[model samples]
Target chain A: MVHADSSRFAAGMSTKEVYAQVLEQARTLFDGQRNWVCNFSNTAALLWHAYHSLPAPSNAVNWSGFYFTNPSNPRQLILGPFQGQVACQSIAYGRGVCGKAADTKVTQLVEDVEKFPGHIACDGASKSEIVVPIVKDGKVVAIIDIDCAELNGFTSEDQAALEELAQLLAESCDF
Target chain B: MVHADSSRFAAGMSTKEVYAQVLEQARTLFDGQRNWVCNFSNTAALLWHAYHSLPAPSNAVNWSGFYFTNPSNPRQLILGPFQGQVACQSIAYGRGVCGKAADTKVTQLVEDVEKFPGHIACDGASKSEIVVPIVKDGKVVAIIDIDCAELNGFTSEDQAALEELAQLLAESCDF
Candidate 1:
């Protein structure tokens, strides 16, 4: 069942209002369901829905989803449930944008995929991307990756808000 | 391992070239993978990445994904793997844009979401959307739904190309 309360956010809202609401929604949704899969699934959907509906730069969001550390292989990150196209099955540590984020436990804010050295062109159309690691007990358990059609699509606000959401997920959900 | 052949499509290319290449890539990627999840997953990712990277209009794509008929509940469309934000988990027959497309077995190219009556406000930022039903054996199997941040984001070419891709999926992948 989908959330019937679609009026939670308006289309004309600023990026800050939209993201703040998204984070709030994440907390509410995640609190009710502490499972990692359920939480990530709903959170991804929330992020996608909010960003696409928000005003520009945030409205330019094309891809909003997650990739988690492959339990079978600790050093690799496997595709978790996401909302976009067929992505790479697994990414090794320090390999691509996701890999670097996982390795360093730092968010990688890529302004342009074309300029990012050794960028993994999983989706050729993704011009810019941001990968935020969900750190649990000082270890990155998963990453939230968002792609946009426009270069420099993400701003400091996006980073701060997403990082806050990542912290919330790490604290609340068991991944 | 990810696809290392990033030189196949250049950023400066035309939308037609990018979309054509995306279709080709879909074919190659879906060759041995007939599972619906694999096909839809890759297809959504492919569309999201390609459309975002393409020149404006097409590059304005914010959400590119699918909705398939729920096996347990045939009259409804269950959310499938997608590339955008959180979407309606289940849509009844003849309801919103996706439901109408699935119900009528016709493509719905909505130039403006605001004008489309009964428009399900899943993503407020989506100004325009296109839904193409994937018919298999005279029955509606699935629908490819793409949303854009700008109004009138989809052109006739997008419709034709996506319909073709939908047909390919209908024939090649098993739900």
Candidate 2:
């Protein structure tokens, strides 16, 4: 089992209902996923689809998951876990939160889309975000990102939880 | 020019005429060798040599430096930088200031080594000590160590200066 919670499993739920339900489930799931959790647009898409289709859903919503036009020549997010539709695999530094995190070596957590200075709207529905830097040897190697549809969805508990997760990832992956 | 001042240069000079003259000349030459500062051992060695050659040289001297042998392997401070011949490279966490700094991720400046519980004595002549951790990604990666012959050899100013230098190295080096 890849660690799923029964509490999030709801009966007689619509896709939107499931989306709402699973997200709540995912909060705990993500927290338990090795103390760090990140998702690309694809992962985001998969999450969206999974949320929409509680038990068994269609792939329609899945297709529209993580999609971002590359601002840099070679845009990719490298190898990590993701969901939803196919994502632009590569991204450049200073382009996306993924890129900017690489460039600045700083963790970025955006609570609202409108307030984000350079908001890259991969999915207009995503309104909140948390990006934790995975650093090694005094350098930022990668980031663990989580996107949410609700505003102010992430809290300090989320931040602390994710930070610990990031540390675990850095230690395990040798980042 | 790689940021060297005469006063700072003099801080690294020794009282011995031969060593003082050599350090003075080395300061000028060191400008071009900025990129050469690598590894905890190398920086430790440089600081050790510099401290030993200070203007007001101590009569009784003791010195040692520490390195992280296991990146994830906790509980040990492998010997790193030093000036005097006596050294204990490998020390367990909770044993000495070097190990304790790594354990606590806090800088430790002790006026007298004797007062510190579990102080590991690589050199019996050492009466005072300072230890600063090199932190990255919110974790302690290494430490800058200083040992002196005189009691209360390290002041707050020395702590601050060494801390600044340690941070510089922490930000500059890869590991």
Candidate 3:
């Protein structure tokens, strides 16, 4: 009975059919939805309205978000569930590029952010970025941030479709 | 120099000139930015992209966000900065209608969340709601939840223009 009918995910599809219908509507709107803030607030509003009609430089996605690790600041990184603008709420673990992708767990393809050296502009028109980390079981439970205004806006098929939607949000939220 | 240029707060105004140019662009993008999570992440992306071109039973805004007070449960409320959909992360201090607008600090105009009795659906196509509260020195800092699919869809001129943008975000952020 998976039917929250988001108009059956419509809108001029094809960016690989909108990330394959946004990873099959984030596994039917998050299987078993164990409330990680309501499955990261409906998976950050289904990746900010499914990359707003993907065509040009990945449809110029201004920003899309998530950033976790607040078991009382596990080395820092708060601000979770987002859409866009006004950010930089925590990020300390290693410092920038979302604390070096949460201290190198992996996935940071930052195409520009003015040559990413401790880049934390937050949104001075975020020119390009991508950070994915959601490694449960062994740890690192969340991290998926995306920003773009243009310059080299993300792709290796948008980082293998956001690392398979961050491994189905680290096996269906509950972080 | 207030140049955070959110495309000069675009969109064809009117709704009292887009809430008086979104309270003068949230006081020039939050005057003297004291950083309450970057001024509620650019005042919830300037009221979810400035009410997306108003006029559809008041531009059917599905949601816009912010909900603070949870530094290890300071009476509860664990979700801040939002856009739409997944919600209800934490809410105690009086519960629902964003904890009675943070325990009656004020502003909870529900034109109809199927008759707000303890209404906490999160987002089943949110029928109508508005909850201002961002007190400051006198207390209760943070809470601006807006949602609408239609039904009465907010007015008292959007509760006195979001209670004057929640008294200018409780006198400009840094909560």
Candidate 4:
């Protein structure tokens, strides 16, 4: 059980810190899993699990599930492992935040729920969200997504750190 | 035209050098093009153009022409841009070198002609070639291909440089 102070993993931490923390935590959490690299599915599962176990965690953030799509249906991302209430299992590319992130491969960190165009309300209370593209061999393979129940929850540091972690996953994992 | 010392862009150059020179020269060659991204289609075009322009370039390198497929049709890489007499436009995703690279985002650098499995002989003289994936988001969207008329023509540096160039394109362009 490797634990870092919650303050160190705050929204506005530096890019280096955010990435280092995710990788460091992931390594600690999944070190025993027998795989060269864990896919987005596994990462999401771990994040959900961590969110649930953390003390004084908010209810608005649903840390319950993840999803992926096969090459035959590249346009959609299907649900994978998750922890809170059940979520919409499928999202089309270009539809919601998930879709837009998949289409552009650029991170989208939205501070307000109402401002986002085509915001998919899996949890209506989710006020802020951060979505990062998982790139492998120069193309987007999947995405790392975090949603906050509170408004203005994410920062540039969060975005940078998640992007680095995404890059590391891309290099090490197959999917 | 921005003519590089052809020797600087030699067959044995590192992957980084290959990427830098290709981009540098390409920028000069196609100065005003809006999208400078490389794909299987455009990469094939680059090889075709290079084969025709460079003096006494190896005849054994048979990048004379190539094709790629849209995801809708997995049967082949449809007839794309090329510069040679005979070319195969469509190839199954599991069939030839191009298909294999598409299947796995890993770079395939072939040194000897006869040793390669599924060597699609568009031209029998092609003794060596290198294929690097052009990734966007996390998927392999295209491949940067280099073929030499001579045996064992590509090196690790060439692979690394081209991979770096591929990364740069993925970061800089929206393809």
How high is the CA lDDT of each candidate model?
0.78, 0.50, 0.74, 0.53
- Model 3 chain A lowest lDDT segment of ten: A1-10
- Residue B61 local lDDT, model 1: 81
Q: Is the docking of candidate 2 incorrect, acceptable, medium or high quality?
A: incorrect
- Using TM-score as the measure, what is the rank order of every candidate, best first? 1, 4, 2, 3
Cα lDDT for residue B108, model 3? 87
- Model 3 scores what on Cα lDDT? 0.74
**lDDT per residue as tens, model 2, A1-175:** 2122222234566655544443444444333222211222112333434434443222222212222222232233342333321123345567666567666767666667678766665456566776676665665655666666667655575456556645544554422
Provide the TM-score for each candidate, comma-separated: 0.60, 0.40, 0.32, 0.41
Per-residue CA lDDT of model 3 for A1-175, tens digit only, reads 2233431347678777877877776776666445565566557667777787666677688778777776755777776667765465567877778778877878898889888887877667778889888888877767888888888888798899898888888888767
Better of 3 and 4 by lDDT: 3
Instruction: Provide the global lDDT of candidate 1 against the true structure.
Output: 0.78
Each model's fraction of native contacts: 0.27, 0.00, 0.24, 0.00
Tell me each candidate's i-RMS in Å: 5.3, 23.4, 9.4, 24.7
Model 4 reproduces what portion of true contacts? 0.00
Candidate 4, residues A18-108: lDDT per residue as tens digits?
Answer: 4465577655534433221123333543354344333322224543223444344777765433333324446788878877888887888
Off by more than 4 A, model 1: A1-42, A45-80, A83-86, A89-175, B4-9
In angstroms, give how far residue B70 of model 1 lies from its true place: 1.5
Give the distance in Å from residue B39's predicted Cα in candidate 3 to where it truly belongs. Answer: 20
Clashes, model 2: 19
Weakest 10 consecutive residues of candidate 4 chain B by summed lDDT: B32-41
Q: How well does candidate 3 score on lDDT at residue A117?
A: 87
